[model samples]
Target: MGASDTAVAMSTKDSSEASLGATAAGPTPAAGTAALAIAQARVSQTDLTGLTLSGRYLVTRKVGQGGMGAVYEATHTLIGKRVAVKVLLEKYAQREAIVKRLKQEAQLASSIGNEHIIDITDFGNTDDGRTFVVMEFLEGESLAECLARETKLAEQRILRVGAQVASALAAAHAKGVVHRDIKPENVFLLKRKDQDFVKVVDFGISKSLRQSSEEEEAVRLTQTGMVLGTPLYMSPEQARGDEDLDHRVDVYALGIIMYEAASGRVPFSGANYLSVISQVLNEEPKPLRDIRPELSEEFEAIVAKAIAKNRNDRYASATEMLDDLNAVIEDPTHSTERAKITGPRRLLPKAPKIPRIAWAIGGAGIAVAAVTIIVALLMGSKAKKQLKNANANPPAARADAGVATVAPPDAGEMVPAVETIKLTIVTDPPGADIFREEELVGKSPQTVEFVKNNKEVNVTAQLPGMEGTTSINPLERKDGAEVKIRLKKLKGPPKVIIKKTGETGPQKQQGGTTSHTGGELGTNPFAGSGTVH
Candidate 1:
């Protein structure tokens, strides 16, 4: 079968796909052939800082090195902006064919300016004939780093990460760009205030439609007898060396990434590259539930769809994967949709609640900056002169230079119908100490109110011996209206456990009943507990 057909077939099949490598009646190569071949293609490593490109970009530290080229972190002298530059070595730089393909990589990536895909700025070669491509420098860690740091990500966070990557892939596909290499190392996780953002990098091995149809059909970009990509992520068609590859290959690769992100394990792992390649062709990944039983059913179905062995059974595009992910986020209750497609009762074992650290880092710095800006604006307005020609009787100005004072409007008038609003905090347990913006307030099941004209307010609840804190967004409430908030208990530490009866586990409650269900768990510092359950 052709590459595209093989890729489609592998991606669309359900769980019935058979194993390919060891059972197939084919002659396999020597055990170390793949590694031996990889070892022979070594090019001498050179310092990236030695090369000067684009006049202003100075290469700094080396980020990665591959068979074809090496990547370096570079900074623009004038703008002080950082970027990643991939430099083809001097030995391969003289080959016109390789140089042409390398240039195409930069052009294709540059054509798509979407935020999910790595941003490419420019490409050029130096006087010494070493070619380099300039790309944006991502500030945060790679998905690989994140996975390693957390070991395994939270179910919601994994879905969020997948959705972002899917959006990037959709944009690239719309522009006829297919990311041939989609792995954790190539995926960047940018940290923000509320959540993490994802970006796909390294389109160097990607294929684009800019090439002629004839070239696209038969041209193999890899050098003679060279392995192009990481074995774990290669799609079946890519492993089989078929030339008619397309977007479906990317889908298959993304499936593997999602699998790893959710379960902390690759779907197909073998002793060698060929075995891994064969498994991609014939094997079915162990169901996600089997690996991480605590993951939600909706997420399992999403993983199943992405990992389908037939292209038709899987999502038609990355956009479709993103849609499913967003649907789960919008309604976690819709998880039952998986039971309809699969079997009944794949209840993801309840995930052990892990305490999220109270990360109130540098709040003071941000507050100070905001206050400075507001003070500066107030001072600036005070210097403006008032116009009073026709109306000569103007109000007296303040004696302070740069400061102006005005009398309150209608102070003598009666307070306009003082309206009363009620704000109530609802906790799982009926009563817990309440707080507002981290400051202790009252107890739960209590009502409070803000006067009209208050723009925003925060309400929090805390229980003794519980690491969890519940907060409410008082800004959502309108003036003179009641607001009811149901605060979901935050995970405390990792001390909570399941029991067969109605009684709680080892932890004790405040009233001495020893019921710990609604209370905080224990500490899981560094995410040492591999699986949540």
Candidate 2:
């Protein structure tokens, strides 16, 4: 049978039924191969089981299936290392745009090496022309699943998760990438080393900020004027189909995520997608604290700023938002208040009943008598010992006693005594503007002094077409330490070179009609795909 015919037939039968058919007869080697072949012919048009890709990954069984592709549990044949293999379905393999988008997701995600972002190991096409990407196999449920089971999360837990996500976004933004879709489904919660860790997944709709004006205008993957994000979590500009978008859209979606995580429901929702989109574009969401009165006003303010209708009103950068979130978490008074909000208020037990004046007078009289007797004895003993010590050694005895009896200096006072270390900042391309803790601190190839007690100093280098960042921990080394940073050139606008077939000279192309020299224009794949969940 033709490949297309087989795929059509496979789509008609249930996946479970096909799996049962593969193991119905026996577990023998020959029977297994036969069953696998039969199942392949009837479903998927390709037998992924027992198949090896790139002569390394051995596909075992399907772990996850999606509209565009399916993820299989695989192991490296030589190293026996576990990994996940996501393959584009045979049905969509012929769709060039979908194939490109699947590959783009892998490339974009792999480029950002953040702990909170999923890691892509490798990507290529199989011998049978099936495209696939290998990624780290993650354990645990998605944030969406957790929220479904627990409804809402605690205030501290929200901040912890939000901070990690914002940190990942900061790294992406530094590289000029924007994660247009931010929702619970994309936030994965994994348990490693008995601690909860988050990994942001699915960059299928992420936009690159490095594209040229012409390229950006030419690439419209979605329907004309159609919104490109989930209605419930979409930013105002995204819902309005504004072409001039930046990382702020991600901030808006993150706000919606925070709001939903704090309360059981999202800030904006309606019976239908259109209604939700309308609310997102034209109306303001109700205050988060109003829905969950237990939530603090500070928390609500953070969320409100994130989902602000005007992008200019939102946090300037993900790092700025993260700093504010960390501040909220570290504030003692705010934390205590948050605890009270989440927990039930309890009344204190009543004090014991007593005659207030009589009890206080009796206690005072006994204390005064005990103190007077103790003072008299201490004075007598001290005088006798001093006379005897003076007669024996005098100055020598006094000096010895002084050395032994004197208390050490306070711990707090010693902090200022340590000399500040000089940290020399040098970059691959010198003269880049340097920033410490978001404050501009002269140009690179400069030296700054920091107290030894300072554990770490964050440095950011910015130039016209290059940028870099690093953290220097003076405590890790001795004083006069030098931190060398390497700045990478940012992606520049695409250069257009037009050639005329008949004429000897090149022609200048203008407007959207300018044809790109190579490859088709890009588009947002999530335009008509709906919410990834």
Candidate 3:
């Protein structure tokens, strides 16, 4: 399929049929409607029921479909065991690039020997020249469906799912594999021994960070300017179409998914592909406490690190992230005094005008620079006070001991304070709460003072009955400009607009296969929320 819809989903209608043995059959689709339902998907739909593949597994029914292929539920004709089969579209069979990509998806997935990774047991060409890969059939819903059905999961459930995902990524990274497309839908969850068990699926666009000498030239499917993976969850590097990518992309995506799980919305969302990408590269997601103040500082800090704009600022590896996540799970009150190690327990502000010193200089430089600037200003107060005293008592006043003298200026006045500029933040409604750079500064219609720190900051206006909006300001400009934002009053039911990027012809080409349904995903509800078959 396309990059956006390159995923598979489990059977939604019936799971009991799985109990049937080899000789048994599942419910058959109503007579003529079979073709219509498949066709409605906008693919070269075909009812593959009753067809046997590789002379071993029998295709029972079509389970799901994607950009370049269709997934079918099948059974082992001889052993009676069930499996999921992904078949390349007949038209794409002749294209070497498409064929190689599908084959590689299977090979790379099979290489990672993690219990949480879906098991790929068979891959080969069919009698008609089409390719197929058979995998273990899962029995539960995708994380996408689970979220739709239950908008938010309990904290414990989230922790369990998160831990398993991190564990799986660690194994994948250790094998030099990067699941370039990690999102809620790519994460499959079902019950295992009375507890939630996770099985990460869809490795269609994954890359091998560590490739063998012989396979190097043949495996570069992504061209110089091509951008793969869903725009909503791709890392900043991936969004920019950068050539060099590694495991950190998955780490970044995992944080996005976790943030969505906790807040019921993504940090960045918009009307189309370009809009969402712009936010991802330039905007910071809302803070967890802003939406759910009950969240622990540890959680906020952990997620902040995962999605940091600079890859070096994120956790060095999935293993490192899991360590902190597991701690928060054990005891929410645990002091995540890890700021000493990760720099601070919060998201770094926007990139500064001066280039971020290379990590080659280490984060310690940043910490020292930040600490040095403040200390340099306040530490000289003693000398400034001594000079003031010398100026106040002119040797003449000391000479004439009886002379009245003016009172010495207060100590606070002795030290020259950092220059400050006042920014009057006002919303149309006038009563909304304002947050400047993720911190609750004050209510709208209020004037807040900002130091001339030469850094960029974004201010937001939000209220219960009104829609929120954010504006970015160059707080360093030293101009005390007033920021005014307008809030829309909520009238009735909030509208849910699912913007499709397909109709925009120019963007599709510029986006380079932004989504897989071949832009034919006309009514797929999960269009922008990550591929769910």
Top-lDDT structure, candidate number: 2
Residue range 153-242, candidate 2, lDDT tens digits: 998789888988999999999989898988999899998766569999888778888866664444335345566677889987887778
Q: Rate the local accuracy (lDDT) of all candidates.
A: 0.59, 0.66, 0.65
Angstrom error at residue 290, model 3: 0.8
Worst 10 residues of 2 by lDDT: 520-529
RMSD of 1: 25.0
Q: Point out where model 3 deviates above 4 Å.
A: 1-45, 212-226, 331-533
Candidate 1: C-alpha lDDT: 0.59
Runs off by more than 4 Å, candidate 1: 1-45, 217-219, 225-228, 330-533
TM values, all candidates: 0.53, 0.55, 0.56
The residue-by-residue lDDT of candidate 1 on 1-533, one tens digit each, is 33333433444341122224323644345323433433332211246463456578877788878778888998898989988888887778887667766777788877877888878888887645678888888788998988888778888788778888888889889999888888999899887775788888877677785678765533345667645567798876677776667777777777788889888888789998778888877665665666777987667666765665545435678887777777666444555453122211212223222212222235553464345435534554242122112113435533443322222223343123333333333343446554444334345444344333334445544455543343334344422111223335455643232333543222221111111212111100111111111
How many residue-pair clashes does candidate 1 contain? 18
Clashes of 2: 1
Question: Compared with the true structure, what per-residue lDDT tens digits does model 3 show for residues 397-501?
Answer: 333334333244444433333444444455655667666554555565544555456465556666876755554443433222235566787786433322244
By lDDT, rank the candidates, best first: 2, 3, 1
